[model samples]
Structure formats: C-alpha cells, structure tokens
Target chain A: MTIATFPPEPKPDPGWSRYFGFCTDAKVIGIQYIVTAFFFFLIGGLLAMVIRGELITPASDLVDRAVYNGIYTMHGTIMLFLFIFPVLNGLNNLLIPTMIGAPDMAFPRLNAVAFWLVPIFGSLLIASFFVPGGPAYSGWWSYPPVSIQNPLGHFVNGQGLWITAVALSGVSSIMGALNFVTTILRMRAPGMTITRMPVFCWTALAAQSLQLIGLPALTGGAIMLLMDLSFGTSFYRPEGGGDPVLYQHFFWFYSHPAVYVIILPVFGIFSELFPVYSRKPLFGYLYVALASFIIVGLGLIVWVHHMFPSGVAQWMRNLFMVFTMLIAVPTGVKVFAWLGTIWGGKLQLTTPMLFCLGGLFNFVFAGITGIMLATVPVDIHVSNTYFVVGHFHYVIYGAAVMGIFAAIYHWFPKFIGRMPYEGLGKLHCLLTFVGANLNFLPMHPLGLMGMPRRVSSYDPEFTFWNVVASLGAFLLGVSIIPFLLNMVSAWIRGPKATHNPWRAIGLEWLLPSPPPEDNFGEEVPTVISRPYGYGTGLPLVEHQDEIERRLDLQEASAA
Target chain B: MTDTTLTPGSVEAHGQHSGHNLTGFIIFLCSESVVFLAFFSGYALLKTSALDWLPPGVEGLEWRTPLVNTVVLVSSSGTIYLAEQFKARDNMALFRGFWLLSMAMGAYFLYGQAVEWSGLQFGFTSGTFGGTFYLLTGFHGLHVATGILLMGLMLIKSFIPGNYSGGEQGVQATSLFWHFVDVIWIILFLLIYVWQ
Candidate 1:
C-alpha cells in the first residue's frame, strides 16, 4: 500500500504587471493579446460609428469623401488584423495547452515574439492616420493600379505603411500558426489521442493549418505590391506590362480562407459551450470535429467566388461557385450538431448559452445569404453592394463576435477565478443581439434596392434603412458599456469560483481557477475519453480522484 | 489502458523532442515553399501574357556565371549533409570542417550572384522581365544569406565546450534550411535562366 505524495505547487500568479512586459507564459501572453486586441476593437468600432454617422442621411456631409475612404479602410484592417485574429490567437494561447494537458506551448519565446509584433504593426497601422495621405483609401483589399499610385510622392505614404503593416501582420500570424500547429500536434498528454481531443483543438488545428498554407500568398503579394509602390518593380502596373488582376488572385487566395480561419474557432466555441449548457454530449462528435478540415479543404478553392465580378473566366467562376457552396455542407453539419445537442436536453440559458444561441441564429442567416452570394448571377447582381456588406457583417459580427463573447463569458471564471454578474451579462447579450440584427438586417433591402457600399451618401429612397441602421449602430455602441462594466466589476469584486464551476468535462476544468503558472503542474491529467461527456457520467481523465485532490491542495495553499 | 508515459531523462523522450522540432522545421519550410510558389506562379502568369519577354535593348540573362553559381549552391547541400553525418558520428573535427566548407560554398555562390547582378545591363525598373528577374533572385539571395548566417552561428556555437550536449537540433534545423534554399535556387534557375 503505497501512498503517492503530491508534487510541489507552482509559484503564485505573477500580478498584473506580468502582462505589460515580454513574458513567455502563455496565459499572460494570452491575456495581453486579448486586452490589446480589445483596444483595437474599440478603435475599429469607433470608426464604424463615424461611418454610420456619415451615412445617417442622404448626404456625405459628416466627413470628406477621401476621409470616408480612409475611415472604412482602417476600420476593415483594424477589425480583421488587430481585433478578430489576435483575439482568437489569444484564446488559442490560453486554451490549447490547458485543454490538451501540456504545461506550456511548444515554443513559448516564439509565442511572445509573435504577440509583440501585433503591437508593433498595430502602432504602424494606427500611425498611418497621421501620415501625409491620411491612411490607405484603397479599401482593405488594396488592389493594384489604385494601390500603386502614390501621388503624395513621399516614400513613406499611407498605402506604403498599410502594405508594410499588412505584410508584418502576415509574418506574425505565420509565426503564431507555426507555434499553434506544433503545440497541438506535439504536446498532448498521454491517452489524449487525436480523436479524443476536444473539438476546439481540432478546429484550431484546421484553422492554423489554413494560416500556414494561405497566409504566405498574401504576404508574398503584399511584398510585391510594396515593391511596385516604393521601388518601381511594376509587378502590378498596367503600363509596365504588369497585371492588376493577379494581385486580386493573390489577395483573395488567402483572404477568403481567412474567413474560415476566423469562423472555425467560433464553430469550436459553439461545439464546446453547447454540450456544457445543454447537458448533453455533442451529437455526431466525430463528424463535427472532422468537418473543420472539410471547411479548410473547400475554403482554399473558393477564393475566386470573390472575383466573380472582377472579369474572371466563366469556367473559373463556375468552378469556384461549386466549391464555395460545398462549404455550406460542412458548416451545415456543425449547425445541425449544435441543434441536436440541445434538442431534448435540459438547457441552461446562461449568458454564454444565450450568446451561442444568438450566434447560431445569425450564422445560419449569414450562411444562407453566403450561398446566395456564392451563385455567380446573384453575386454579380449584388456585387459591390450593401448586400455583400450585410452578409459578411452577419458572419463577422453577428456570428463570430457573438461566439467570441460566448467563449469569454463561458471561460471568464476559469480565466479570472470569479463569476461574472449574470444580470449584467444577460443585459449585454440582449442589447448586442437586438442591435446587431437591426443594424445589419436593413442592408439586405438597401442592397437589393440598388444602394452601393463604400459611398458616404446614398439615394434619398435608401435613407430610411440607413436611419434604422445608424440607430442600431448607436445601440450596438451602447451594448459595449454593460460588457465592459461587467468584466471590470466582476473581475474586481465578484464571487470566487470553484475549480469546475460549470461541471464541465475537460482537463482544463480539473485545474484551479485562474490555473497556476505551469498549468496542471507535474501531475498532468491524462485524458481518457473525449471531452463533452455531459449526462453520461463518464470519467474524462485516468486518475480523476488523485488529480482532483492534488489540485485542491494547490488551490488551498495558493489561497 | 493506452498509457504512453514518456518518463523524463529517457533516451526515448530526447528522441521524441528532437523529432518534434524536426517536424516543426519541416512545416515551416513547407510554408516558405508556398511563398516561393506565389512568386513563381506570378512569373509564369506574366510570362504567358507578356508581348515581349525581354526588354527591347537588353539580351536575355547570361547563363555562364549563374550556372556556376547553381553548381556551387547545389553542392553546398551535400557538404552540409556530410557535416550533419559527421556530427551524428561524434567526429567534431570533420563536422566543423564540412560545416565551414559548406558556409564558404554558400558565400561563394552569393559573390557570383552579386557579380552577375552588377554586370547586367538592365535595372530593376527596366521592364517586367527585369522586375521578376531581380525580385525572384534577390529574394532567393536573401534566403541564402539567412541560411549562411544561421550556419555561421552554429559554427561559432560548436566551439563552446558542451554547447551541443543538449542535442544537435540547432545544427539539424540550420542544415535543413540550407537545403531548402538550395532546392529553391534550382527552381529559380530553371524559371529565370533555363526556361527563358
């Protein structure tokens, strides 16, 4: 009869100052990423508000035409590069190691380097606002000919800075994707087979793989564009016998899969939270996990759908149309799996659950419009219109952002060792859901009625929907107040959380709240079964009782 | 019970760690290859569409020095491989020798490239041909310089006693990168010099 003595507990949580410096601890880096990205998110949201304000009436009186272009371009660049991508990478840093029972990421220092590049390039991007030409007005795509024309004659122009920022961003993401794929593939604990891993990790694998394969094309393209703009390479100049459409091919090759890179993790969040809140195992779990790869596979061939109105050959357009529509199949499988998970189970409508539900509804709406946009006829008709704008907002904000919120709420306890105020959480969710629908829903009608996007002013007939959308945009702006208030207050003075507050079945839930410096310490919990074992009473880990006692002792000592 | 506990301080664990690093480096190289692919595809597209492949006054690329440069660069891959083999066999003297030889070959190749660039009549802004030519080769030359620098670091680190006591993963990764640079040059050689 041998009694096993527990190992020494890890050092206490380094206080808040750890985040400001170049720390290699994945948890600290994760929070830094999230906090920094949120700062950019607020900046992007403010830009959107300004744009909506300009479009409130039938005139471009609020800002100059050139300023409007810069505003929208910065808005798109900040939201995608700074907000969505970094925030998700932050979540990956926080969650992947804990879920897979690794003590740290594969290359922690490399991870820190990737994090610091965000701020460096993010500063460059924001600084372009103060530059000579006042930031890139050539849209986020920054296609050639227009992109190459540097009228200011200053070498350090807005388009130059934008391209430099984007190229550096591509480098940062490639480093991040490399780290993620290596960590997930190499660092899993004993008994955590590929199949037994949580679906979130699977989605991370798929999404990061897309980053590995697709990001370089855009990076390469950005470099060539920079060369043409600055060094007179003429790779995209028409007079220099360069093709502008080639840049479009390069940009969309990565940018189209980039949507999947954003949404796939949201899908993972949906998979994880549904089973926890609904008290049922994720239905067709294997299918849901494998479908992420399917999305990745299809996502690569479908970038030409974005070029339908760009004078692509008919065969190319039709081929990409089929590929784009095929994406809906895998996406549909995930939606079905979520519905089935919650169909007959005891549902807990917590803030996280509510957000997931809202996100799912919005995602389905977005998917339908996405399929419509996939069809060449419909896409050609609504090309460069508000309909395209409406559909993507439904995906990016209505679906992906809402899913991020759900993930934040669901994991807030684990992150900060406290329970968020449900009253405030629910209020925040209500405002966001209603405000988002009202803001984006009217764009469909406006697009069908022939109101083009990127214009500060519109026809007088389109003014009604614009008013509704602007009011909704203001309401959406208000929705952020409750969310910020709840996070700050709850983090400061909320009730302390237990190890497994939600009674979730995963390796992360077995650790202390705000898990120790090296998550799981010496006694890594070996995952025995797949995650999401809700209502099945199956033990998720091999030595569950022993691990729980060790965790409890650590928590007691820390307190 | 599928218990696959990797006990610390075991040889198997060390091998697994090295294997993990190799896999990561390979994946990184795969991504680098895609970046090159983007440029190559761009070159192919432009070549198919252009009315005149070369600028009006200038002749096509001179293949003599580039051919010698290609030979020098490609042969360096073999030298680096020999260095790794010697390091694996615990012959530190031969390992350092072959490693230095490989680095010299890489530097010689760079010198040949610079000489070729200096002699060229056309400049970067001359036309599509000059643009693609310089961009592809210059970009590739940058990679070669990076590989040489990595190899130089490895050579310096080897002099410190017990520097590689942990493992030779650094040397291995550097060699892999050198090889990747060599392979890319072959393709660039075909596209820019031979195919033209």
Candidate 2:
C-alpha cells in the first residue's frame, strides 16, 4: 500500500476555560453536558438514598409523607431529565461527529444551547423544594387532577415550576433531536453510506426521532396542565367539564416512548462495545441497524400500554398489549445479535465489557417483566404496585444506567486520552450489578403482593422485601464513589492511552486519542468498509496506513 | 492512484447539498405540529364528551369575523410564497413589499382574534368549551405573532445589501414558518368555528 501524506492537525486545545463558557465546539459542549449531568446524577442518587432510608422500615419515620413524596418525585425527575438524557446527549456530541467524520454537529450553537438548558431546568427542578407547597408530589408523570390541585394556592407553586421545568426540558430535547437527526442524515464522511455507518449512529437516529415525534405532546400537555394550576384553564379539571383521562393520554403518549429514548442509546452502546471487546464483527449488522427503526415504529404505538389500567376501552387495551408485546421482537433481535457476536469469540473481560454483560443480563430480566406488565390482566393486577417500580428500575438503573457506565468506561480512553483504573472499574461494576438486583428484584414480589407505589408507609407484611431493597439502594449509592474516583483520578493522572487501545475498527479509533479540535483535521477519511470488522482484516477507512502514521506523529508531538 | 482523501472544506460542502439549517428547521416544524396535534386531540375529546359543547347561557361562536380572518391569514401564505420567489429572483423591493404585506395580514388576523375574544360572553374559566377554544386559538395566535416577528426581522435584514448573498435560507425558513402558521389557522378555524 502506498503511504500518503496527511495534512497538518488543527489548533491545539483552548485549555479548560472553554468548558465553563458558552463554547460552541461539540466536544467541549459534550463534556459540559456530561459533567453537568453527572452533578445532577449525584443529586438524584442522594435522593434515592433518602428514599431508601424512608422505605427501610414499614413506617414513614425518616421523613414526613409529603416530604417523602417530594424526594422520590425529584429523584425520578432528576435521574431521567437531568441525568440520563443529558449524559447521552454528551456522548452523542463526543461520538457522532467523530464516528461519521464530520467537523462538528450540524448546528453547534444549538447543541450548546441544548446543554445550557439542562442546568437551567435542573436548577428549576431543584428550586421547587424551596417553593411554597414543596416539590411536585404528583410524581414525574405529573398526571392532572392531582397535579392541578394547588392546595397552597400560590401562582408559582412547586407543580407550576415542575411543569415549566419539564416544558423547557421538552424544548431542549426537541432541539437536540433535530440537530442529531439532521447531522446523521446530512453529515457523513465520503463513502460512509447509511449501511456503513456504525450501529450507534443508527440508534441515535432512531432515539432522537422518537424525541421529535413524541416529546411535543407532553410539552403541550404540560403547558395546559400549568394553565390549569396557575391560570384556571380547566383543560383537565372535571368540575369545568374537562376530562382527567385526557391528561394521561397526553402524558403517556410521550412518557412511554420516553423510556425507549433512554434505552435505545444504551442499546447502541451495547452494539458498539460488544464487538470491540469480543474481537468479532457485529453479527447481522444490517439487521441490527434496521432493528432500531423497527423499535421506534413499535415504540410509538405502545404508549397505550401505559394507559391500560387507566380505564381505557377493552379493545384499545387489547390492541396496545399486542403492540407492547411486539416491541420485544426487535429488542430480542438485538439481544441475540449481541450474544452471537460474543458467543465464542476471544472475550477481553475488560471493565466496559463486564458492564455491558451485566447490563444485557439486567435488560433481559426487565424485558420479561415488561412483557408481563403489557398483559392487560397482569398490568391491572399490579398497576400501582411496587412491581411496576421494580420492572422500570431494572431497565433504567439496571440496564440503561449500566450501559451508560459501559460507554463512559469504553470511551474514557478516547474521551480523555487516559486509561481508567481497571481495579476500581471492576469494583464499581460488581457493586452496581449486585446492588441493582438487590435494590429492584424484591419490588417484583412486593408489587405482586399488592404493595402500592408512591407511598411512604406500607403494610408490616411488606417490610422484609422493603428492607432488602433499601439495603440494596444504599449499596447502589455507594457504588458511585468508586466510579467518581476512577474518573477523576484516571483523568488527572493515569496511564496514557494510545489510539485504538482496543484495536477497534472505526473512524474514531483512526484518530489520535482525545482527537483534534476538528476531529479529522484538514483531511477527512473516506470510509471503505463497515464498522466492527474486528477479525476480518478489512480496513475501515481508505489510507489506513497513512492515517495511523499521522496519528503516531501527532501523539509524539503532543507528548 | 485511487485517491479518496477529502479536503475538510469539501467534506462540509459535500454535506451541504441538502441545506442543513433548512432541514433542521423543517424537523423543528414537525415537532411544533405535534404540539398542536396534542391540543387538537384534547379539544376533540372534550367536544365529544362534554355535556355542553358551549358554555351555559352562551351562544356558539360568531362565524363572519373568524371567516374573514381565516381568509386573510391564508392569503398571507400566498404572499409569503411570492416574497420567497422575489427574494430568489433578486427583486428586493417586491420581496420587501410582499413580506411586509404578509406580516400585516398576520397582524390583522391576530387583531380579529382579540376582537372576537372580547365579544364572547364566556371566558377561559367558563367551561371545557371556553377552555379548549381559547387554548387552541390562543396558541395559534402566538404562532402568528411569532411569524410576524420573524418576518419583521427578515425585513430588517433585507435592508443590509448582500445579506442574501449567502443564500436566502433565512428568508426561506421564515416563509416556511409563516406558511405553517397560516395552515394551522385554517385547521383551527374549521375545528372551532366552521365545524361547530
């Protein structure tokens, strides 16, 4: 192969101050998103501990009933909107342009605005605690009737702030979704056809598409709910001849698919990491890529499953149950594809791989419970029970959060140009896996035994499982210390990572570790083959030899 | 030598085939439409189920003013389209005239809505009918106001010579948004007035 000369690298990093300012660089904005999201994650985790403390006994001894309601409500809201969504957006900022060989996101300024909105809305959500009537006690779903009841009669009550915060989050995510979809569809390196793109991009496309189509309903609904609370519009109040069920329809229309928006990226993380750690090509790459859209199609129709127990028509319930069950087929396709990729390969058993494995295991369990909950009879039996809690926690905390940790660990080397301490990472993984199961698994039985959710006190008979879950939650809280330590210490002073540390075959790995300001500099790579060509000996980009040489030179100069 | 390297500028130029900003804006409009859909669905649901379609002791909406307003708003869509055409043909004067006319029409429609609101006996707190009616029209009225503001900005920008030299994507986006606002008004008129 002829060695081709490469262009000069772009300007060096602008140092740490760019992160604190309104920087438009996608990478900086991405790190800003991640760090800000992680801060909210710590807050959410602390609330979880408080919740566990209350649930440790069968009585509401740790906090007042209303206080407990505020804690758990904020916990769910912070974890979903403030943490998972923004961290995933951060990863999108860091990965999408580099993977596709674009210079930056389609709208870099919009991306920065999206990141800034996270902190804005996060502060709004946190500020609710100090407001009259405390935080929103109607849960994250914020279903009306209960939500519209402003007992304190303040115009700027907690529920009003909560609604405003949620509406702003909706606006931010919609903007983000537009940017991602446009970038993925329009911006790609030469010869990187839709099929040749990595599965992560495909998943991002699917997930963001859901955000575009579904989020607005929730936003519009929230605005109406806000009016009902503050302005007396009666969009949901029954005394004014409004229907409370309409709010449920509006809320679940997005909130149900909102789960998929969170998990699909985790699914993408799984697809990207499995092949790298297992030393194999992704099994059925085309199928895996196509499966994401299938999930999106199926995901939109299944929102009605969440409304099954809300006195929806019987025929509607039956139809939604089938739609909800059908989602498992596409999801199952991905799970099997991961298994097939890792089945007999030379598994690395790295920290990222371990987390992926644990995540996949948890996801399968969550999927089973999800299917069970989709059944009209089963859902009705455990509609408001702890069973519902256990099922989602397994998905959110167990699968999606674990998948996020995997991506962070997997890309840490690429993200910060340093290898995370493997010992700390493994300890974090073990504790998370054990604690997640211990925390959530017993909720299944509690739910089946008719232990209702969103309650501070429960029957004495439910105490044993609640104790186990509380202990598990405390352990889960402790699990974060090791991760934080690893990220900070490893970033500050760890072994330097070379590009392609895992020998991953993708455009991102073709660049120097931490990549340049403009990712590919002045010469963008022309993708020649599919990603995850681990054992095939196929080059990912044309001029692979020259690119490697140029990366080495760049690293040498930096050192 | 099969050379496949792409210059960084060319990489951007390659992706620029489809206008990135326009595409992003169109996607944004799709989300905006969904928000409107949510409100429409609420309105439809309440209309079907409520005991009184209109507030007690209040008559149905007067149709003549709203009908005239709808005609005015819908015609603005055509005027905005002409504005886009004139902008493309480099006729700045006609573009400015048509753009201003469209904004004037939009502002007139909002004025008509406010007048109609004042004429009504029932307020937002009257009943479900009053709530849905005000929310839907008020929301659409907000969009119309926004469209007028956007047109005003474009009109100002047009004064700076060579502003459209980089392509009239901004004008095109504003026109698209104005058209969307107009179309939503048609739907709102039919749902709240004509159908009722």
Q: Which one is best on lDDT?
A: 1
Q: Candidate 1, after superposition: displacement of residue A557 in Å?
A: 8.3
Which pairs of residues collide in model 1? none
User: What is the CA-based DockQ of model 1?
Assistant: 0.45
Any runs in candidate 2 off by more than 4 Å, and if so which?
A1-13, A556-559, B1-18
Instruction: Please report, in order, the local distance difference test score of every candidate based on alpha carbons.
Output: 0.91, 0.89
Per-residue error for A541 in candidate 2, Å, reads: 0.8
Second chain TM-score for model 1: 0.90
Model 1 misplaced stretches (Cα beyond 4 Å): A1-13, A549-559, B1-19
Score chain A of model 1 by TM-score against the reference chain A. 0.98
Clashes of each: 0, 1
> Can you give the lDDT of residue A201 in candidate 1?
98
TM-score of 1: 0.97
Clashing pairs in 2: A387-A447
Cα-based lDDT at residue A69, candidate 1: 97
Where is the poorest 10-residue window by lDDT in model 1 chain B?
B6-15
What DockQ was computed for model 2?
A: 0.52
